[model samples]
Target: MNIVYSSSDSYAPIAGVSIMSLLHNNTDADEINIYMIDNNISDENKKRFENMVDKFGRNIVFIPRPDLNKMSGVDIEVGRWNISTFFRLFLCTILPDNLDRCIYLDCDTVVRHSLREFWETDLEDKIVAAVDDCRSDRYKTELNLPCDSTYTNNGVLLIDLKSWREMNVEKDFLDFIIAHNGNITYVDQGVLNGVLAKKNLVKVIHTKYDAMTVFFDFNFKDLMKVRRPEHHLSEEEYIEAVTDPYIIHYTSCFLSGTRPWNENNNHPFVGDYLKYKSMSPWKDFPQYPDVRKKSKKMMTSVCNAMPKRMMIAGISLVHSKLYPMVRSLKGKRRG
Candidate 1:
């Protein structure tokens, strides 16, 4: 499977760690290549990442983009123009050409199961596969879009690169940003939804494929059964669930005050995060301190400024606590 990710210096270590988790746990893939692009990375950090991939038995394609430092844009929440504008260049041009189709994952996710299901499933000629954000229904109506599964999270994409290029998607998407002068919520994601909606070029993949921490309100266990139907797991079913996820998107990094990696956060996946961290080669890298600091700052800013729904927060907290108990009970039942 071809995997793609874009991160700046602040995220390469974690992205490298995430890639390692994918390689170690996902056995179904014949080969996995991580396409990582970072312009701001220190040579030391870059070398550390390379060494980590080397030790972990995965192929790494590292692209260094020195020219990206000049771009700038407002982060809106921080009241300062941050440097995420460079991602536009990545979305438009810098990607590699070896793969006709690719799975684009944010650096924050850890794959618990083979992504073969996502990569192998036909897109039915659609350019991408994504899930609608739970909160974006209101935004969709405001934008005059039909209230279907239209507001998608771009964090996990099953991209049909050929279709993306054939449809001139990148150019048209960039033009939309240019026309709007880069003022939009959620950056590239919002513009992507604006451009792709009703175009018959996007397919709504199973939400289980990208089970975001932000939207845990729905009956996901049921949804999982329905989509990958006939595969039902009772509350006592422990191994079955862990062994079969398509992707475990740790989108909590996108939320403020809510990450397992943070010192004072109650993230559901804290144990799992630590598990991956313990196996990471960054344990020996000298830049660990710097990486942790930047990761904390990024997650803090995102969570603090994001709009909160009390119900969602409550459910998330409950799920975090309940899941382990449920898993324990499932194990007993299975035994």
Candidate 2:
């Protein structure tokens, strides 16, 4: 199996933990070829990654990050995400031609099961397969996609390089970016969904493959109420995903600066991340202070400590009553 990750020096330790987890969990697989889209990672970090992979009897290929300025016709403003995020876009251009398929995992993930099943999943003539984004319909509207279209999270992708090459996907992606330069909200993710979802080219995979933090943190009923209608995970599937997730995408927590490695984070999966970190080469890595302010942490703690029923009721009232009234008042103010 071919696994790809993109990271820079700043995120190398976190990326190392993710890679270690992948290697640790998928020992049953016959072979695992790891590839990293390098963003000038320091030699020390590279050695650390090498040691971690070597310990697992696996090897990694470091593909140099492509110059986006040279690759794209228009300048891409990579917001909160690093330039390495754009590296996935140019996999076909950067990787060797003989490599036909690869599984792309974001650095903010930890694998919890053998990926043989996921790695062997058939793309069914699609260029890529991914989990449906939690906010699928919102993304659809943001990108002006059809209501029935699937908006996928690019975090976990099973990519078919042959299809990408044959269909000139690279050119299409560049063209899309140039055409919709300033309109993109989620950087490369938005561009990917905008281009591919419109063509009906993305295969929607099981959520377990990219089980996000929101899957565990949010009430399932509340989640369903807010989710797009096109996200068609059955209750059974949803339960299976939450109960037996293969990959934990610490996406929301990571973005909110409440990642497990942060001192103030109390995310449920922080223990899981710490477990992997203890086993990794960076076992002694220190947790940094939380990026979230102390006041926010206190507020979050108070809210989290609320009784489940009360919490749900409060959220429901806010969504069903307060939010609509606030919108109405804003409209009246405009009038």
Candidate 3:
């Protein structure tokens, strides 16, 4: 199985924890080859990745990072995300030509089960398959996607390299970036949804594969209330996804403003993360503190204290309506 990851120097250790989890859980797979897009990873971190993977009898390759500025000549707004986030857009150009497909995982993900079934999924004519994002249709409208489009999270992707190269989808991604003047709030996620979500080229897979934090923290009804998604996983599927997740995606919580690695976080999957972290080279790494400001933490408390419906209405108004408007206006001004 070929898997891809991208990380900056500071995040390399976190990515290593995820990689170690994957290597441990999928010992049954015949071959597991990793390719990481490096953004100046320290030699020590590189050696850690090498030694850890070697311990599991897996092969890994490191690819040099590219200049986003040089490629686009447009100022890209990466928000709080590392610039390495855009590396996925250039996978067809960066990965080996002979490789037709590979699984792309975000550094925040911890693999808990064998990925052989997910890896063998038939893409048919689709260029990519991923779990749908738990959000409102308003986000699709924000992205200028069709109402019928199912917007999937880009965190865990089964990418078809042959199809991407053949269709020159990178051009589509670049055009979206250039057109938006790189002022996307959601960064590469915006590009993926804007470019591919409407074309019926992105298949929405089972949510279990990329079970994010929201599913665990909120039930199906509250999720609908908060996210106001036009469509989403059913209650049965949602329950199963979170309770028996195959891969735990430690995305930040709206209420906590933190992930499992943070000392103050209350992530349900923290135990799972700790299990793999203990076996990683960075086992001695310190747990991160909750870095959200006092004001932000206060707001989080306020939001949690408010009636669920009120919190839902307010966040939807800001997230789906106001926040996207700001992104669009910023893009237009930049353009």
Candidate 4:
């Protein structure tokens, strides 16, 4: 199994917890090789990863961060998301040429099951396979994609590196980013979908492969009530994903915007994260302050004050109607 992740110094420990969970859960696999794209990670953290992977009898290779400045329009500011999020865009360029395929997992995810089947499955000539997430008709329209095209979460990707290199996807990614005038809402996410999904180059997969936090917090009915997605998984599949999720992606909650690693977060998977933390090389590591300031505290209190159902309804109304109307304005919707 080949796995890739990107992280900076501030997020390296959190990424370590996710890696520990992956190694701990996939012991049955014959071999697992991890490739971490370095982003100013401290030497201490690097050693932690090396020692951890050694103890697990796995391989860990640290790839030096590539220069994004070399790419046109890469200097554009991306909201909240860091430059590391764009690292995967150069995978075919930066990784070993011999590697034909790899699974790219975001640093925020925890693996709960083996990925043998998912890794070995064929892509059927597609460049990548990922779970369909963040569905919205406006997303396609914003990118000028065809009506039937699908949008997927770039968080967990099974990439055909060989095909990507053949098609020069790295160049295509740069062109898309530049064409958008260097302004992308979700940074690398918008670029991936804009270039790949528009051409029908992505294979949509089950949510079990990347079960986001939204799944844990809401059932299909309530999710529709809150998110108002244009497309989504069926009720049966949603339940299965939540009940036996293979990869738990601890995305921020809409109600409170909290994550499992935060102190006051109400994420149901906090226990899972804690268990993996205890098992990692950072087991003795102390928790850092969650770094909330007074303004954020006040907002959290305000959001918490609302009734759950009322908040869901309000969010539903905004997502299904008001938000779409707002996005319809030129330059408002992200590609």
Output the number of the lDDT-best candidate.
3
Over 198-232, each residue of candidate 4 has an lDDT whose tens digit, in order, gives 88899988899999887777768888777766677
Write the residue-wise lDDT of candidate 3 on 1-335 in tens digits: 99999998888878998999999999999999999999999999999999999998999999999888778879888877888899998999889999999999999999999999999999887889999897767677767787888788889999999999999999988888888877775789888888888688998899999998888777788777777777878888898898899989988777757787888678888988888889999999999878877887888889899998788789868766676677666655766
CA RMSD per model (angstroms): 11.4, 4.7, 1.5, 2.2
Which ranges of candidate 3 are over 4 A from the true structure? Answer: 328-335
Model 4, which residues run further than 4 Å from truth? 293-300, 320-335
Model 4, residue pairs in steric clash: none
| Candidate ordering by TM-score (highest first) | 3, 4, 2, 1
TM-score, every prediction: 0.70, 0.86, 0.96, 0.93
Q: Write the per-residue lDDT of candidate 2 for residues 221-312, one digit (tens) a residue.
A: 75665443445677777788888889989875312337777786666667889999999978898997666667767756665687866755
Q: Could you tell which candidate, 2 or 4, scores higher by TM-score?
A: 4
In candidate 2, how many Å is residue 253 off?
Answer: 4.5
Q: Which residue pairs clash within candidate 3? A: none
lDDT of model 1 at position 282: 66
Reference-based lDDT, residue 298, model 1: 73
Each model's lDDT comes to: 0.59, 0.79, 0.87, 0.83
Better of 1 and 2 by TM-score: 2
Better of 1 and 3 by lDDT: 3
Top candidate on TM-score is 3
